[model samples]
Target chain A: MKRFGKLEYYFAALITITFSNTILGEGFDSTAFITIFVALTVMYKGLVVIDHFMELKEANRYLRMMMRTYFFFFPSLIILSTMF
Target chain B: MSSIESSNTLAIFPRSWSQQNAGRVPGNIPIWVGILSELTEFGIFFTAYFIAKFNYPEVFASGPLSLNTTIGVSNTVILLASSFFMAKAMSNVRRDDYKKCERYLWYTFICACMYLSFKSYEFYWNDLQGFSTKTNEFFTVYYYMTFNHFLHVGWAACAILWVIFRLRSGAYSAKEHSGLEALAVYWHMIDLMWILIFPLLYVLR
Candidate 1:
């Protein structure tokens, strides 16, 4: 479990860096695609922290749901703000 | 040890809570409550930010352009790495490896320090470029949000130091380290918040 958890962490970190480069790279335009990409990337990073790093997966259903909901809810909000 | 005796030994948390949530959550229930409250607070901040952006669309539109994207990305990576080390610390503690836990905590602290340093420089760079709270509505919220997050990271750093001290004095063990777990959860919360904040202020154009 520990080894697999470490691999998960590394994978999340690698994904974050890869997307960050795309967003921060030169002349990168923030169109609808980039906006959605950023929102999804942020959501993915938050989930990793909540579930794997915080080990909320082993937690009670309510506890896990509550924390997981934040990631989803806020990214939805971000998407809403962008559309408007 | 009797259940009661073990509960007494772990009196940092309410005995009932310790018993009730022993395997239910990652840390103390009270800390989860605090985390919930903190998340709500940030929720309010995000609402305010969006409202301000709605009111001042022009200001919001150009806000990310002036900011240093490099600094924002660096800080994001730093916090992510720091959270990783903190998680490792918790795993070590769970394995009854205090030495490895302490080492990982130090690594977390170093990453935290690097974040603070980069943030300080970012602020300095902002000042040099004549961006301040008074610069515009965007900067006003920018300063408010980042400063609030900074205070949080500052508090978490102090908590990390305290946890290290207690760990050294044998206050935590594999079986009863709710305090350490709580600290790890709190640190991860900080990281989670930054994950939201980074794009809102920097990458989202």
Candidate 2:
């Protein structure tokens, strides 16, 4: 079952991540907190998909590094967009 | 073995016995070139969306309310599931489990269709509410962001279909599955782009 490992958890996490953020967001008008939470989860979810699903965990260092770095960097642009 | 060899111009990792060909992109150079170019184009589109949003924060923040968050979240999950199935298909292909690989591809394709249908419904709902690309700057960016992704999804779905057909013909094996891997990578990239798009467009109020 190595192939099936954590597949369910990823699904559960994806559902939980989006809904919790969407639900918790209703309570706070604080855009910063909401955005920070979303960004963190975006990074979390993106990395998970990259390493686990894409199987890039064992991939070439350049591609792995670039792909993971892209996850972290993309959200920064979103936050910066709001600032500027 | 750790580093890939670069052309004579520049080498990344040290020239080692095991890594003699490490410089090449994974899943062949051609697909990497295509994926990178496609990502760069989307990167520009995303940059444009954010710039427009920056100029009109009020419009941006207020726009998502009229749209359904549930639908957006569902679409995101759907795409993620599709990516997972594609990944599984790739793994199965790697294991030479040809029949299961084809089944997984079918699952991924079905998931893709579900996502496209749901997205189409969302677009219809927006249109019924008079939300068009011409609505305003916010709607303009929203349309661009979603539709640009929609177009990519179209491209991915087509590629997936071709990959499925190939898998059906038993053209891929454990050692010769680079084509399948390339399609999987492209699909994952589509999923990757949407993870950011979903929150930025729908949830970041």
Candidate 3:
């Protein structure tokens, strides 16, 4: 079971790479939309890993909250700063 | 007979005989705090990357063009494999298998070396092409973000080496291996940071 979970994580990583590359090959105007969408997808996948695989949900609540804030805020801030 | 018996009894509680032994075992802090600190540091670098991208999107686009995706993907796999070895090392330490722990640690070290080697090659290639920190805003952020990650890789390698040495010396028992715990956490942080970096810098437009 644990081995399967690890393999699934790796599969997700490969998908992310493929998705990002596809976005990169598009035109700039199209690239921005794809990039944003890809970013969101990456963020969602990361959060799922943190919450489930990494067992953050079972961890200290304060720590879990801090991680949630750090992950969401940092990436969102980066994307927004870039876009605007 | 009485004096000899008394001295033999004192051997088990030798700690009461000296002040130095009182501090032998240090306090064990949770390893998660160290991991969090590293995550925050990487966050700052990511923020800088974005700020640069906002100010100069063209430069960012050009910078990505120069990056060799082959090397990027290879390094990503190396780090991912290293994470697995690190986890195995931790598991071995928990199981009191010092030999297996050492083997896994050595494997992790090799992966770290591979990562550093590829990064050095990239840096040399970039430098030869004149894509330096002063080239443009994009190059500046690229160098900064990637170089900072390289530094973390170095630190992690050193930590892994320390854990390996301690394991070899039997300093870490199954019941108490905080060093291994801390290093494993640190290794995961390195992997997690690269996950974001590979996409943002190499793959994304």
lDDT of 2: 0.78
Candidate with the greatest lDDT versus the true structure: 1
Isolated chain B TM-score per model:
0.88, 0.88, 0.82
TM-score of 3: 0.76
**TM-score of each candidate structure, all chains considered together:** 0.88, 0.88, 0.76
Clash-forming residue pairs, model 1: none
How far in Å is the alpha carbon of B185 misplaced in model 1? 0.4
Give the winner by lDDT: 1 or 2: 1
- Chain A of model 3, TM-score against the native? 0.59
Tell me the tens digit of each residue's lDDT in model 1 across A9-55: 56577456545644553367667777777788778878878888888
Candidate 2 lDDT, tens digit per residue, B1-205?
2232233212333544122333334465567678778778878877887777777878887877778787898898889889878877877888899888999998988888888899999999998888898988877878888888898888789888898888888788998888888888888888988988887788776
Model 1: CA > 4 A from native: A1-26, B1-23
> Over the stretch B1-205, how does candidate 1's per-residue lDDT look in tens digits?
7976664333565554443454466677678889989999998888888899889988987998999988888888888888888988988898999999999999998888888889999999999999999999999989998999998998899899999999999999999999999999999999988888888888776
- Alpha carbon lDDT of residue A34, candidate 1? 71
**Fraction of true contacts kept, per model?**
0.47, 0.55, 0.11
